[model samples]
Target: MTTTRKPGERAGLTPEIVFAAARELLAEVGIEAMSMRGVAKRLGVAPNALYAHVVSKQDLVDHLLDDVLSAVDTQVATQDPSSALQALMVDTYDVLLLHAALLPAFLVRQGARGDNARRLGDGVKTHLESASVPAERVDQAVHVLIIHTIGFAAFASHPNIDSNGYEQPPAVLRRDFTVGLKWLIFGMLDC
Candidate 1:
């Protein structure tokens, strides 16, 4: 049986589906090798079909980055500013480590203007403000936190090419991140 999709007809394809496929493809081949055509091929659709949902490869990557950023747990589990900030930052670090493929995109986008990005920013800013971080230094603090989280995740995700036997396992890397995150939060909050 040979059923065919009409030209310009996407069948069941949706933006969500496209983004999902892109995420999977990125996870498999990384951002460098990921392409609109590659994503379309994965979905078994013509490459042109993706344009109906995404304008370009950059647009798709932007969406994917924002989509992943939405997963950051922003809830303040405790009223204590230091503890809340630590929790938020740890959650953010974990998310970045988990989706390391999007790290480059974050660097390019820089706290992307997407709604999810706005929400995450607002959440962090609220915590910082609550902690009485000086208004003049809040933005700088945010940038430092973003850089630290992304930078560390990128470093941790890189393959251990050291022939001199310097390798940190996942557990060690995670512990290091937690320790670093604690230092950043406490220093920023001065708590």
Candidate 2:
């Protein structure tokens, strides 16, 4: 006789479900405490069950990164290159801020081989090219924008700094980000 499948035993598990559960677990316990076992526990599944969808913790993090990056609005690439680039950076910063807990993991796993990452990179490259930024400087410009945005986001999300009274008000922070972005854009154009 064949045994009946339990109602909640892996029958409802999907990569999306796993990702959502993992994200919640990450937010709740942080990266150091986040693990397949924790995610499985959150989903009410055996730890081994998560491995069927995500081969390892790193793989799970990568998938979550992809999901987070996918929310970045790259459609601005069709507009003026300078504004498009700045918008992209701002959008990236917003996404990073929303997932601040995962930023450290994202930084450590630098090489994210995912479609969303590629799309963001491609949008930046296309915008730079459209702006007539010299071929030799496009890569450098892209690096500057990405690195600066990520660095700023990481810095902005530091709770200690905010608690220490070193944090700027929201308006001041936006102005500072815009000024820095304008400087980078102009520098690229002048090169």
TM-score leader: 2
lDDT by residue for model 1 (85-150), tens:
778877887888788877776766664557787787788889899989999999888888877777
lDDT of 2 by residue, 77-189 (tens): 35688888889989998888888887776667753458998899889999999999988988888888877777777666774335566756656666667789889988897
Give per-residue lDDT, candidate 1, residue 126. Answer: 90
Q: Any runs in candidate 2 off by more than 4 Å, and if so which?
A: 1-9, 159-166
RMSD of each: 4.4, 3.7
List the candidate 1 regions with Cα displacement exceeding 4 Å: 1-9, 107-113, 159-164
Q: Against the hidden reference, what TM-scores do the models get?
A: 0.84, 0.84
lDDT of 1 at 45: 86
